[model samples]
Target: MGEADRIITLPAKLATALHGIAPGLITDTLAFANRFLPDPGGIGEQQMDGKNSETYLSNSLLARLTDEAAEANNEIG
Candidate 1:
């Protein structure tokens, strides 16, 4: 399994940490997570070319980080 595959399968906490660090590297290494990590919402059905794949992965990482930040805020507030 590739780094992207590992990230997708890992628990959210660990995944968040791994994703937060060296995201650019992950983006560079990605070979389309759709092959292994099927999006339950059917978002992965579309073909992911190189540029699209990078954007999608980056957006996904950002979304996960945002979610974690929101959760942290809730805990603190």
Candidate 2:
């Protein structure tokens, strides 16, 4: 898979794995933005407005990590 695919797909995969290991442990918020983002290419700047505090915070962190991972993938590949 490509870098963008990896970035978008990882979180949901991880969440599913976690849920499998421990049923009812994962929240839907943990899987947010995994299937789609309003602005995939500019994930960092995309407004996460209207989301609840917890969901917003979770998505913010996910966006940060996705950007970091994408950068590293670009640097290495």
Candidate 3:
């Protein structure tokens, strides 16, 4: 499964940590993106084109630091 699928299947706590993307909503978005009808918004189009989201996430330094912290937590605990 891809990232979306993984996110969709995650438990509530992890999903919350992943920006409050409830499992149901993520699964629904994936389903909508794959359906035959035209998408209500540009979501499917953006997914198809694989463009970056307009909602900028974090600067490279911050993201790297976060990743490193997660990795350390996983390894140590």
TM-score of each: 0.25, 0.24, 0.23
What's the candidate order when arranged by decreasing TM-score? 1, 2, 3
lDDT of 2 by residue, 1-77 (tens): 75345545777777666776876445565456455753343346666643322345556866788658768888423
Assess each prediction's global lDDT (C-alpha) against the native: 0.60, 0.57, 0.57
lDDT of 1: 0.60
Give me the candidate number with maximum lDDT: 1
lDDT of 3 at 10: 55
Off by over 4 Å in 1: 1-10, 25-31, 36-77
In angstroms, how far off is 40's CA in candidate 2?
Answer: 28
**Top TM-score model:** 1
Candidate 2 structure lDDT: 0.57
lDDT tens string, model 1, 1-77?
Answer: 65555555457657567668978766655655545764444355665554334346556866677658768888424
* Model 2 worst lDDT run, 10 consecutive residues: 49-58
Q: Report the candidate with higher TM-score, 2 versus 3.
A: 2
TM-score result, candidate 2: 0.24
